[model samples]
Target: MRIVITGGLGFIGLALCRRLLEAGHAVRLVDSLSPQIHGALPDVLAPEGAEVLRADVRRLGDHPEALADCDAVYHLAAETGTAQSMYRIEEYTDVNATGTAALLQALARAPRRPRKVVLASSRSVYGEGAYAAEGTGTIVQPGTRSKAQLEAGQWEPRGPRGEMLRPVPTPETLPFAPSSVYAATKAAQELLLLSAAEALGIEPVVFRFQNVYGEGQSLMNPYTGIISIFFNRARQGLEIPLYEDGLESRDFVHVADIVDALVAALQADVPPGLPMNLGSGEPTSVRMLANELLAASGFKASVRVSGQYRVGDIRHCYADLGRARDVLGYKPRVSLAQGLARFCAWAAQQPAYQDRLDAAAEELRRKGLGT
Candidate 1:
């Protein structure tokens, strides 16, 4: 199969490119290679015979048709950040939301179209997620977290009678209630790709990925990937900071497992339908992740549990990987501990870059995005 992948030069995209090449598929990659994601373009992005198309997903004349001569496309390009998205509203929307539209428009003008379109969606679309009330045993899915609630440092959602709610694994059936501009863009990407694919006589598959972390992820990008941020802090012997009482949780899926699902999506005999989650299905707290990364890297710095919470942040959300398991026959092979250990071993050999998380936070504060 000839495959075209947008964002195909980044961490996950490069891995997919390698795998597709190994499977005897000719590959072409479309990417802007933003400095934030890739500090500098590496000399080599893939095995020989793979082509790289240099273009921004939002820019015309070079996108969409980049998918020409391909059997399928894995749309993975986006501006990703939860807290930063609160401030960089226009950039996130332009890249993630309008970027998808550009691809569809490009497809509309093309003489030929890829038979299948696979979108890389995020789990953030399920804001607040499905929660079970402790007292009433009822399920509740709330909307956005108010600025008042965030200002008061009330991180978790509550029931009518003040009952504590437990985080439940959110499924695809739950209505979208994205809190941040980034999450909203992801939801919009899904809607746009699927709707446009249907109208254009193309098959579309949407994968709502969990927090994917592993080797090749940019350790210097402080605005995204908590694991990479912690790894950077550990490399510099700096303290890892935690927000929201250190209890906020996420389903941290290994990038390898994510690639596995992506590969499975190519071969699986499943119908194009609603978004399906690709995750480990196990929730790990922020503090726990920090501790694990530090320990994995053999760093002695203690994590700081700062009570300050970022605006547009969620308290707890994980994947309900049932649909992925059933439909794609997917299972996560690399455990968190195993994946972090591998990343640490590889990172120890690389130059430890400066940790810019504090600077990122300061930028957010200057823009009045976070408290």
Candidate 2:
């Protein structure tokens, strides 16, 4: 297939570009090159015969010619993370929302259409994920904990009679409770692309990615990926910080597994225009992951459970993966220990941590985005 991937130079995008090229597909990548995401540009995003464009997808309507004759379009460009997006509202809206709008507009005006269109949606849109009341046991989307609750250091949502709600794997059917601006933008991006592509008689697929991590990720970025942040901190012998009593859990899926889900969606007979959760379906707590990274990194550092918690951060949320399995025949092959080992090896090749996490947290504090 001939393909064009927006944000093609990004960590995920570049990985996709390489996979597609290996499969003998002609690929073209479109990227805007935001410095916040890419600390430094690599030698090339696309492998030896593929094309790369240092262009913004927000201007895609003006450059519709580049997408001509492509068999599919993978939209992966966006500002990532919840806490960072809470303060940088305009950047998230412009890059993630408006950029997607331009791509859809270009497709609408173009003379030809592609066979498929896939979007990089996120699990963050589900907020606290599907939860069940302890007594009644009815599944529901528990809303974010109140400021008063957060102030009292109560992390979990409460049912009537003060019963604790237990978080379950968030399925695609869970109503969106996007807690941060970034999550809202991603949720909006999925709706816009799916609706627009369906209107144009094209099949659209949305993959709500979990915490995707592995090789080639930006270790400098502090606002996302707890695994990378912990790894970077360990390399410097800095203390590994955990928030909210260190029990908050998330689903971490390797980048290779994420690529498998995308490839399956592209080729499989998945029902069109439905979002699927892409994750390893295993929940790992912050404290456990921190300990694992510390052990794997061969570094000595105390794990501190900071009472501080970021506003809009969830207590626990992992992917159900049922839909992904049935729809795309997807199953994560990388175990957490294996993935951590791979990451630890990758960390040795990267530069030492610069302690940007403090600055990142301060940026949020300056805007009251953190509690």
Candidate 3:
């Protein structure tokens, strides 16, 4: 199959491209290589028959021809950050929501439309709704606050069930109650893509992804991935900061597994308008992750608890990936321990991580914390 992947040089996108190439498929890459997450585009993506187009998804008008000759598209480009989205709502909408619409419009006009359109949606759409009675196996309305609220002076408002609210490993049927602007735009984009599929005879598949992390990640970018941040800090003997007691849990899916799910979605016999969750169905707390990282890196460091929580930060959210398994044969194969080992091994070899232990120690001392 001839495939086109937007944001093909990104962490997940690049991994997907490599997998497709190894499976003997011709691939075309379309990416703006935005400064925020830019990395070296490997030579495999530039082999004789491959094509690479430099264009932003938000400005698809400039590269209408990039989608030509492709049998399918994996849309993975977006402005992604939950906390930042609260302040940059318009930016999120423009890139995630409007950029997706623009891509659909371009596909709609294609002389030979692609057979499949796979989107990288998010679990954030379930938002506070995941805490509602309907979502938590209890009956609660949309706006009802959880009884176990965050303590006074906490940064964000607490939900019902207070900090004890546990997300029910959300399925596709969950309602959309986006807490952040980024999530709202992502939810809207999913709807728009499906609607366009119905109206334009396109086949669309949406995958709500959990937190993804792996190699080739940007350690310098503060908002990219928590795993990367922790590894970078630990390698330098810096204290790892935890938000809200470090007990908040998240489902962290490895990038390799995410790529596997994406490829499975493309090759499966799934129908349009189908949305599934891509995750491991395992939730790990922030503190546990820190311990895992420390053990993997063989580094000693302090953990600083900020006791601060971001607005719209959920206590816990994981996926009920049964649909993905039954429909797409998707299963996460990488264990968190193994993934962390691989990541830490690679990180320890980086020149940037050497000789920074003192600076890291100094920063931790100033904060009055250590592991």
Expressed as tens digits, the lDDT of each residue in 85-138 for candidate 1 is 887789999999998998888888878878889999998898877889887778
Steric overlap count per candidate: 0, 0, 12
RMSD of 3: 5.2
If both were scored by lDDT, which would come out higher, candidate 1 or candidate 3? Answer: 1
lDDT of 3 by residue, 255-363 (tens): 8999888888776888677789988889898999999999998999998877754555666778889999999888899999999988888777754533333354354
Clashing pairs in 1: none
Looking at model 2, residue 170 earns an lDDT score of: 85
Q: lDDT of each structure?
A: 0.85, 0.85, 0.76
**lDDT of candidate 2?**
0.85
Kindly report which residue pairs in candidate 2 clash with one another. Answer: none
* Poorest 10 consecutive residues by lDDT, candidate 3: 139-148
Error of 3 at 334 (Å): 0.8
TM-score of 2: 0.96
lDDT of 2 by residue, 35-86 (tens): 7667665444456877877788899876866688888999998889789887
